[model samples]
Target: MTPLDQKINTHFPGLVVRKDLVRTVKGNAIVPSYVLEYLLGQYCATSDEATIQTGIETVKEILRKHYVHRNEAGLVRSNIKEKGRYKVIDKISVALNEKADVYEAEFSNLGIKRVLVDSGTVKTH
Candidate 1:
């Protein structure tokens, strides 16, 4: 870590991600760069090289397990149905359904639509 890097890490721990490491963690996933950076912020925020490497593996594992791919939408849906609930990372768009008088969410990559969302979540997010 250089002097500037060390200074930044000192002042803003757990909020900084090394720029080069972004490419290292980003692998063919269609998600935006901010998403990857957010994950990196959680795990690779420190300037320690060893910790950053371990965090990179952790972020990759998280993407492999939780990220929803467009091609595997059916499988992911099946898994969610079978398991009752499952956590996934994907782009979501929420809108109020005028006809139903309810908030609904659409998962872009997961290919799921009309999933009801609570008003609180809809407002907060």
Candidate 2:
């Protein structure tokens, strides 16, 4: 355990986690630092190296399965096309433009830039 880890465990007990766990868990979550730290505290609030490593993996897995990434939309679409169906969790928005007679789509986290979509095709999240 690093000095900070030992310090936190010594002074704060179960209230805080090791610093390395925070770094390992932060990827594409786009969450505030405190929120990530709080979750780390919940899952990895330990000074033991083995326990901290396990907690890091747990947090990373949670983010991988649940966090939305702007770069993964194409991969999800490809999977759906290849496999006929796939599970995806995302936030999607589309607006119908009567004047243009087309649908404009926006993916909040997928970084899609105003795609012209066929009308009544699919509205998905």
Candidate 3:
């Protein structure tokens, strides 16, 4: 097991995410850090520290390679269409109305408003 993984398993059994690790992720994309960290959490939640570190590097590589800037939505959309699937980091917040029967995605800085996102897209930090 990697040292970080051992530390997390020993000290943070109930914590699903380690936000402190996100700072190690390198990128210039404008999206909130949590978004990238969320993706990292998915792949790097390992009991072995070395594996986790490798996974972290892999996820950072993905962000550095694929994440799009706000002004490049058209390029990103085309890439997504061509690639058939993609993981994007964007600022998203949740809103609950009176009825609470609906959900909307507020894309920060992209100027996209009220787009619907599946509940599955929401991840717990």
lDDT of 2 by residue, 1-125 (tens): 57875776789866875555566666555745665676688777876768877877876776676545667767766666898865544556888877987888876765655779876575433
Model 2, TM vs. native:
0.44
Worst 10 residues of 2 by lDDT: 27-36
lDDT of 3 by residue, 1-125 (tens): 46776786677543445665676664444546766666766777666678778878788777766666777877777777899876676666766443756667776644556766556665442
Top candidate when judged by TM-score against the true structure: 1
Better of 1 and 3 by TM-score: 1
Residue 101 displacement (Å), model 3: 11
The per-model lDDT (C-alpha) reads: 0.89, 0.68, 0.66
User: Would you estimate the TM-scores of all the predictions?
Assistant: 0.94, 0.44, 0.52
Worst 10 residues of 3 by lDDT: 116-125
Ranking by lDDT: 1, 2, 3
Cand. 3 Cα-lDDT: 0.66
Query: Cα deviation of 77 in candidate 2 (Å)?
Result: 11
lDDT of each residue in 1-125, candidate 1, tens digit only: 68998899899988997778788778666767888999999999997789989999999899888889899889999999999999999999999999999999999999889999999997787
